[model samples]
Target chain A: MKLLLKKGRLLDPTLGIDFIGDLLIEEGKIKGFGREIEISEKDLEIIDCRGKLVFPGLVDIHVHLREPGEEWKEDIESGTRAALYGGVLRVACMPNTKPVNDAPEVTSYILKRAREKASVKVYPIAAITKGQEGKELAEFGRLKKAGAVAVSDDGKWVADSSLMKRALLYAKNFDLPVISHCEDPKLSFRGQINEGKLSARLGLKGIPASAETVAVVRDLLLARETGTPLHLAHLSVKENLPFLRWAKEEGIPFTAETCPHYFTFTEKEVEGYNTNAKVNPPLRTEEDVEAIKEALKEGLIEVIASDHAPHSPLEKEVEFELASFGMIGVQFLLPLSFNLVREGLLSELKLLQYLITNPSKVLKIEPPSFKEGAPAEVVIFDPEERYLVTEDFIQSKSKNTPLLGRELKGRVKTVILEKRIIHL
Target chain B: MRHLLDIYSLSSETIKEILELSENLKEILERPIPKVPTLRGKLVLLLFYEPSTRTKFSFERACKVLSADTMSFSAKGSSLEKGETILDTVKNLYALGVNLVVIRHNLSGTPHFLAKHLKIPVVNAGDGIHEHPTQALLDMLTVKEKLGTLAGLKVAIVGDIKHSRVAHSDILGFQKMGSTVYVTGPAHLLPEPKEAEFFEIRPGGFKICYKMEEALRDADVVIALRIQRERHGEPFIPTLQEYAENFGLTPRHLELIKEGALLMHPGPINWGVELSYEMEKYPFQVILEQVENGVAVRMAVLLRLLSGD
Candidate 1:
């Protein structure tokens, strides 16, 4: 099968290309095109990218598809559909499912299901330990061989430094990056949201920002000593941004990503309905958001990932203490990032670089770029349209988008993955 | 439909009818066909802005037992996302034909807001510090179930007197049942138990053991409010160390009180804070008994409010 995207302005942030070109595709790879005449429209199927700006498809390194053990909420099929609608072609899923991706079998199980179901490229990041229990390390080499792109103990961190160091050292042999969810569960202290005045008044427990930064400081040190590649997932707390930037300067082989919700809202938004705004590492203060924004602009943070954890509506419909921590976020990431970029917080090119090229570099999976001969994994978007979010706007089975009823600008027009237009 | 919004909405006459219906429902639970078609054709909406395992889950379980469909929506996933002003979110829930709103918001006037907007009756599970009227009704049901009467008895509500909405709503419900209500706690915690023209305060702090002893000595029923652990941060009591020493319920506490005084507590008890673990298991503890009665009383409230009698 063949597909052609005609006369689209290729905005290649990595190569600095901003000119009109035809994206020629055969099977699932980009053959060649642009200056040379391409195949006829009737000879092959064509997508009219006439006035659209085509860029490398966005990728999210953090999303929770809540599959394997719990398909009632969201499986690979539904979650990839959401990523497709939001202009994401590749995603690194969290290993927080019921039967976590700790073993090669579990990782292979997710990859096998994705092949049969998902429309987008689903990269299964295996758990660092069995069931993410933070105990003994799994077979790192075996897991990587069984189609696992990276490894992470995502929802909560591996508390033992000694154990985490061993896992990091073990992963180096396979050249697999060890992604970490840097948080000290002990520092959470049974708190729900951020530690502040609102938590005191709401009478719920508060998790301190130091709970996160303390872990990042420790893990970064560990990565430096072990000479292992560490990727921090959902890096919240302003203090960690400087540490991450410093790590790169020192050549510590440390990289990090932050979610849209961390930049969009804060502890203040948790006044009434405590659960939705209630996530682990908790939402930080406004100062934290400002710090994260500055990092994005200064190129300290590498990529933006949607720590998209979807809980059943029943579990979240109660008091703050009883509700689960996490909300479905893939359906809103692109629009939200666009809102940030349009607000002068980040340049369009810088934002897309994190969405595309930077994530590709971290995962070591090259998404087909806008080069003359490459696969046509492209995202077509318009940064001008404005829209309101509602229940109907969500594509995931779980209705946990914190963006509901939020009116915002910029919508993902269409998303193409592996020469197939998954969203139109 | 599913929620029991408030107690006052049920009149003195209608209240009796609902209690009898609860008795009938209890008998049905014992029989093979525990299922009821009362809410079979409808949908029950369990919406709690506040947390409630018993009231919320029991309502859901009741909906299941009745063979009725149910759906739950917390503030997290709903319209509370767009900020509160332009999005009440309840209208959309109502448009979906939600038969009831079992609301428990932290704000004092939230359920009343639903009452004003929706034609479907609301079951006010609990609203901020204002009232948890159904909880009061359930405590009364528990008393009547065990003692076989609620009239002409002295019932004392002790502990966390200032913040317990359960204690606030119970005084009124108990008074309507012809019981003389007495409210006493640490001096900083209690209000003079309000009864129209009468008022009386408990003397001194938790140090004043004589006052609480006197209050519980002649009581036929004793309701101890659950003291929140968050209050340990408050300057009011001086310290949890001081409060536990004086007010902590112990075996001595149960012995000093009247033998016939039925003991109770609203649960998720802090084993060492206001009440003891022994008090939780005490024959008079009746805390677990309260949880069971909660379901029955809630069934009564749902029947009366939804039947529109």
Candidate 2:
């Protein structure tokens, strides 16, 4: 297969390149990309990319593809398809599925399913604790050998400090990255949204910022003490910032991640008890959103992840307190994150780095690139495009989002992954 | 007009309209024959998931006054005990040609959930610790009857503001009517103002007065909320005795307020817990008046919703 993308402004932050160019792909490999490309080969496909911005396909390190158990909500095939439509070509799925991915067999099962059914690349992050109970550490070496890229207890935090320290040390020994969910369950007990005056008025129990910050502090301290590389996932509140800064200044090996929802929405989204906006480390205050945006701009926060938790109406269409805590986000990852650049907080290249390069670096994977011999994984988008975020537009099976019926800027126009092409 | 889920969404004008309607309904309640033909053919269902006597009776009596037939469902022997969802149960009610549902559940936003699912009108009798719109309206009605108007009154709500749905609704209701609400209780018992702001009742206007003396000082009205015994679970309050002594209203505390400041309680009040037992029959006490106003206020709500106003 040979293809040519012509006259698009290519942005490859990895290659330090941002210019109007033509990219050539032959047999699933990037042959070349430059201001002018000479093609001698006949029978080559061409994609006219006029008035478009092209970048290496986005990489999202946090997504929950509820396979091996909860396929009704989402599976590898549907999740990867949603990610593909969102311009995300690589996804590292959390290991919180039922019959949890704490064992090598589950990790291998995910990889095998991805190989057979996924539209995009899928990396499985196995559970740090066996069954994610936070009691005993899993076989890190075995999980890594079985195709797990990282280990995390993403849904439940490793509440036991000594146990978490041992897991971090063990992961370091095995050269696997440790991801902490960072929540003190005790403080978050029966909590529904961000602890504040709103929760008091709404009468929904609140999960205070201290629940996250206290846990984050403990994990950062453990990471520093144990000398393990830790990746914090789906950080929401401003309270986590000072500690994150302290950790960074103290030369702690850590990468903090926040999702698009953290920057795009606030605790007010849960008003009228809209369960679709309900999520763990619940959408925070405006100050937190501002701080998160500033952290992204200042590079204090290194990665932007989807943290795409999917749930059916069975989980959401009930009373607010009874409803499950999550919203489907895999499909909105790129479009929402693009708001950072559109708002002039970060350049397009810098934003793309958070979406693509930084996540790859955190997981220690081969970064998606627009260089020769690299896989031709690319996404073409129009930042000027605006569309109503209707249920029909969502590729995921679950249409649970606060953004439903709302207008959102930026849309992915095309995706080229190796030998395949998907047009939106 | 579609639903009375909570007081948070009602504007000040709408609140006055409800109060005025309640005032008109109060005349009907005093009539020898109390029944009205307003909702002659309507079927209203009383779906109470939580145990309630006053709210349930108030709603039932209001439905009777409006000439609407009522069917009651308590969670104890109902299919809800058999694991039937609130939606499924409400769907069953709707299938029975029920025109409206007056639901009281122990979960916040249960009415919102039903309103989203059901086509018929839904009135929130009470939903968990979220809000009791009619109760707030009735409290406002009592205030209006005693003070001539709700505006320009300093309304102090004392007791478990954190857990009392009445406090949540009353604060919003009073604030909407240009009344400055001072919510006083123990720091643990006092609700965080975030919930108040969710109703667009911002701070500075609405005060969280942890000191009862300060909250009661020169207050035009003081409504004592029932201190829920279950909320006594620690770190919340050390003991009921401590809560009653420190935050509870007494005859001595009453002197701190305006000379004729009306004292109110959303009863089934725990006597001697939130207010002294001696103040129960005090001339300024409007606890009984609140009950009467509850039925009147609920009648107005039912009539408004059924009339599609």
Candidate 3:
């Protein structure tokens, strides 16, 4: 099958292509993308993408596809569908799902399920520790052999420094990257929201920023000592900035990431006991958000991923202290991140690099490109389409987010993965 | 007009309106029948999620005094445990033709949540440590009845300001009426100024007193809040003895206040802990007047909310 996307503003940060062009696809492979592509084949399909921005499909390294258990919240099929709606073509599923992806069999099972049902590519991130108990390390070689892209005990931070050091060094031996959740359990125990005056006023216990920064410092030191590739996930606090800066200056083999919420919302969202705004490493202050944006612009924070942890109403519609952490964002990830461009904080190319290229680099995969012979995975989006984010707009099974009822600035128009084309 | 969720949002005009109505309602409470036909056909539902005998009875009495038939729903073992959300429960009540809901939830902003969905008025009896608007109003009414005016008064709220919703609403309510509010407790029990400032209605703002004497200094009204016993484990106060000895209202401490300063305490008080036992009988301690004013103030609030005046 041949497919054609005509007259779109092609934006491939990986190939440094930014021009009005036509992208041609033949047999699920990119034929070419440039100005006025010479295509005279009578059987070729054409799509007019005028006034649309086309780019390589986004790659998000942090998403929770709650399969093997808790399918009621989200499964691989539903999660990837949500991702596709946001112009994401690939996602690395976190291993905090039911039964936990701690074994090679579970990792293989996830991949098999993804292969059969997922709308977009799914990279199963296996747990670094057996059952994510933070007690014993999992078999890294076997997990890697089973097609796990990376290893993380994501929902729970690996608290023991010695165990974390061993996990990082052992994963390094298997050429696998170690991702740290970066939180101190002791400091954050029973914490409902950000530790500040807001929590104090709401009569809710607070999770201090030191809960993340202390853990970040520990993992960075261990990563330096072990010479293993380490990626910090969903950094929300400005206090982590100095430590991350020092690590980069010292040439430490580590990369830090921040989710869209870290830059978009502040602890003020948690006011009035809004459970949708409740998340782990709780939404921080405006100063921290500004710092996160500055870090991303300066390239100190290199990747942006949707830490899209979905929960059913059973978990979300409760008292503030009782409600579970996390707000689903896989579907709105692209539109929310586009605000960085609207604010002149990041160029379109730089934002795409963070969304597409940097995530691929973090997972050690070849960045999705618009080059010839590459698989035809692309997205067409309208950067200026304004729409109210209602529950029906979400493709995910769960609608737990503060963004609901908000008028968001961008919208995904279409997604092309392999031979399939989905229009939204 | 739709709900009394918190005193912070209540306009000075609306607050004065509620207070003035309560002054008239006080005369009705003094009458033998103590009942009115104002809301004879209306229905009021008391949905108490937490165990609160005093607040529930207060609202019930207020509804009865206004001739509104009242029903109470204790959420201790209801459909709420069967995974029913607070919204669903309130919606079910609304469907049942209830005129207004008096909600005392353990979570802050629950009445606000109910008010957003329900067409009927919602009155916040108390919501977590966030606010207790009526209690603040009744306290203010009691003070105004005794102290002439609230504008130039110096009001001090003592004990567990961080955990007391009454203290939060009272501080904001009293400050809004042009009174300077002073708050004092152990550093841990005293609210952080930022949280207090968020709810402040006036520019002059409120004060956080380091010493109990500092809070009591020339105060026209002194309000005591119950030091929550559940907070005992966290070392907020090392011991009840230590708390009472250092911060509790004793006769000796009364000397620091103005000669005729009115004393207030929202009932179900931790007797002898926040207030001295003998001080309860003191002429200045208007604890019972606070209770009497509660019914009158709630009657006024129900009338204003239901009548939409």
Candidate 4:
């Protein structure tokens, strides 16, 4: 349908456009913007976005929608609706499912379901090996050709150096980016949270940052040797952030993404609140959070994916040692992110680049834009909207979101995907 | 499943099940082809940081009964003497994919730490003076073998209770299974735990005659605890002459008790200080039976817990 978003403050960072004008849409493409545009009689709808700022829809390359194999927690329909509600138009789902999602068939199954039921586009990341066992590499070329976006062995690491080097070289042959969740099992055994005063006080096992840093150091050397494009997911351990900084300064063809919780919450949150704040990289101290925030502001972190790992409430309500490893984030990703920019912790330009340009580049896509004749995928949000992020407000099937009870500024007012108004 | 880490972590039901299952294993032990295929594909590594001849041999024999392989390592000339962290050494051993580890250490509560750190099961042969619960279980097995029951028998666990893991584990298991348990030792050796109902201290000379007469009067079961000489900074007994007179149980001392007062000790014993050399082979003395029961008790626990049945 033809629609016009009139008189909005347009900040399309992709085109470096900041103007107050009407954006005309036709056939799911931006027909014109920033000038007085006469709409055709065939124009279907026009809305006044008087004080809103229109932006290019954000893309997240690391998300777990729990589809195909385990849908009791979330399906493609519900998860994508929540994504649209949060102003995310494209999301790449991780492929650690019931059957490990190692083959081309599972990857194609995920793509077909996403096409049939999801409001937004979905890209499935295939497992690095058969059953993600890290024993042998999967058919990366066939999986990628079957629409798997990238390769990852998410829940576990590919430990054997020789096997990982081969997987990296094989993915390189297929031009598939290798995403690694770097963790050394021996170093991380029995560790419940970050090793520090807090973990000691609670009598929980301590996970040292060395567990993360050593893995990062190994991968960095592998990336350097193989000349393969490696992406680090949920970079929390502060010592590893410096390597990403080094990777950039040395012009290594590598990239990394840090989650919002790594910058927003610290290990102290898990100190008294119990298991809800517990996660895999295990939260770190305020010093680490400050380093992540500084890194995000400095452009060392290429993307800020939510890493939205959803789990059932029963899974998290048990003993701290027994609870699951992830927290849901998609429903509150936008407001929590915009709060960072509004609070002056991050400049608007940095936020835009992290949410849009960097992820587009990481996923090797034609960068999204709000320019004339571009795809009409945009997010209009109010910078001053105030609300408390609570379970009552979230649209996801699971209530494992860490943002619950957090008061934040800003809200996505409208989402225009394919000339369709999917949100309000 | 092949390891027995601690007694407390093993449930009462598991203990009872193992004791009952031992009746079946006894006949098999007498056969020429005594081995079974239960653990044919498995391997056990008995690594000890402390001295243990009884438990070490029993575990190795138990592995043979199940037709499994065994590798025993002591601290005498191993890499551990070169100062490697226990976690590192264990991880390296685990890399070799060893299925089970039987560990005995000199520190109290060391088994719990190992259990938490390792993915595999760790059997605590003995950990300091805290627990030798399996030893206690086997001791009970020996007593039950002669007496044919464990109901309301007054069992006095005499001598050095504080320095005795066997005594500590026995006092609890005995009381749990319908036996009146008591701790009899010099007040210095068995100091009352500020508040306890199980002990009555005899803070003076426990000469062989006097202590035996007191312990023998109406006792249905008399368990003489082994005095660990290494625990004492000074002489544990004032004099060997004085200890022989006071705490030692000779043949004459045994005559003061009832006809059959079921004599027991966790052996590798001092025949003179605790029991006379002849008393060690007394018909009712079932010391070896306890060692045999240890494996059966451990197997019941391993099967119940790991099988999730």
Q: How accurate locally, in lDDT, is each candidate?
A: 0.73, 0.88, 0.87, 0.74
Candidate 4 wrong stretches, greater than 4 Å: A35-44, B1-309
Candidate 3: segments with Cα more than 4 A from true spot: A1-7, A19-24, A31-39, A46-51, A139-141, A160-162, A184-208, A266-274, A317-321, A386-392, A405-407, A421-424, B81-83, B231-235
- Pitting candidate 2 against candidate 3, the one with the higher DockQ is 2
**i-RMSD of model 1 (Å, 1 decimal):** 11.6
**How well is each residue in A43-140 modelled by candidate 2, as lDDT tens digits?**
79899998899999999999999998999999999999999989999999999998899899999999999999999999999999999998998989
Q: How far is A328's C-alpha from truth in model 4 (Å)?
A: 0.6
> What TM-score does the A-chain of candidate 3 achieve?
0.98
- Per-residue lDDT tens digits for candidate 1, residues A23-54, read 77777676655743467556587877777777
Q: Write the per-residue lDDT of candidate 3 for residues B1-309, one digit (tens) a residue.
A: 778888877888889999999998889998999888999989999999888877788899998888999888987678978978888888888888899999988776677767767788889988877789999999999989898898989999998887788988888899888899989988877765545565455665588889888889999999988886553335567888988898889999878999989988886788778888888777888988888889999999999888763
> What's the lDDT for residue A25 in model 3?
90
Q: Predictions ranked by TM-score, top down? A: 2, 3, 1, 4
DockQ-based class of model 3: acceptable
Model 2 segments more than 4 A misplaced: B193-204, B229-235, B281-283
Model 1 has fnat of 0.00
What does the lDDT read for residue A332 in candidate 1? 80
Q: Better model by TM-score, 1 or 3? A: 3
RMSD of 2: 2.4
